[model samples]
Target: MSDEACRLDVWLHRARFMRTRALAAAFVEAGRVRVTRGGVQQRVDRPGRTVRIGDELVSPSAAA
Candidate 1:
């Protein structure tokens, strides 16, 4: 992780993907989120994971 990186949960919440940081953390911890870094995709099982500007995040669509 670089200095430009931020916590997964913090990024998610700041991006308005989740209503709260806690919810984002839960979503990540549940393995519902995947991150692509350096061309490799992997599950994000921890909220503390760092996400940089180029990182791609994938998550299941929320039920409507």
Candidate 2:
């Protein structure tokens, strides 16, 4: 991952998708988060997954 990349959980938390980083991590581990990069979309099942600035993320909780 590049230096500009951010962890999935951290990004979610920072973006206010989840109230806490732990919650974000759990959401990701449960495969509730989908990430799209380079036009390819895939479920992110790990909190450690790297997310770049242009990456798109989709999660049910985020819509709430």
Candidate 3:
């Protein structure tokens, strides 16, 4: 899907989305991130999904 379908957990950590791979996988399984398709958003669940730079992640603000 991407240059290579990255392990979502690894991408999340490399992109600074989570402190650890485990946390990234947890967030993904919990439906905390959104994946865009045809300009529509969908929940991301699988840890093996492809991700890319500039892909929006729907995470709660720390202040919230």
Candidate 4:
């Protein structure tokens, strides 16, 4: 996390991935999102997790 870090759910919604913040948080809580940065990749199980710029986010496909 950094000074500019934002909540993962908020970022997801701001990025236009989900139509609503609640949905974004739900998606993250379901462990359907993964983040990769600094050569580290891990699942996002908590919507409140801190996300910073340059962090790579991977979401499950619609068909999943």
Model 1 CA deviation exceeding 4 Å by range: 1-3
lDDT of 2 by residue, 2-61 (tens): 788999999889988789999989989989989999999999899999999899987774
lDDT of 4 by residue, 1-64 (tens): 5678999999889889889999998999999989998989999899999988898888779578
For residue 17, what is the lDDT in candidate 3? 69
Q: What's the lDDT for residue 33 in model 3?
A: 74
Task: TM-score each candidate.
Answer: 0.90, 0.84, 0.69, 0.86
Question: Could you arrange the candidates by lDDT from highest to lowest?
Answer: 1, 4, 2, 3
Candidate 4: the clashing residue pairs are: none
- Total clashing residue pairs per candidate? 0, 0, 0, 0
Model 4, total clashes: 0
Q: Candidates' lDDT values, in order?
A: 0.91, 0.89, 0.74, 0.90
Ten residues in sequence with the least summed lDDT for candidate 3: 54-63
Model 3 ranges off by over 4 Å: 1-5, 62-64
- Tens-place lDDT digits, model 3, residues 1-62: 55755667888898796899998888888777787755677788887677665565566653
Root mean square deviation (Cα) for candidate 1: 1.8
Pick by lDDT: 1 or 3, better one:
1
TM-score of 3: 0.69
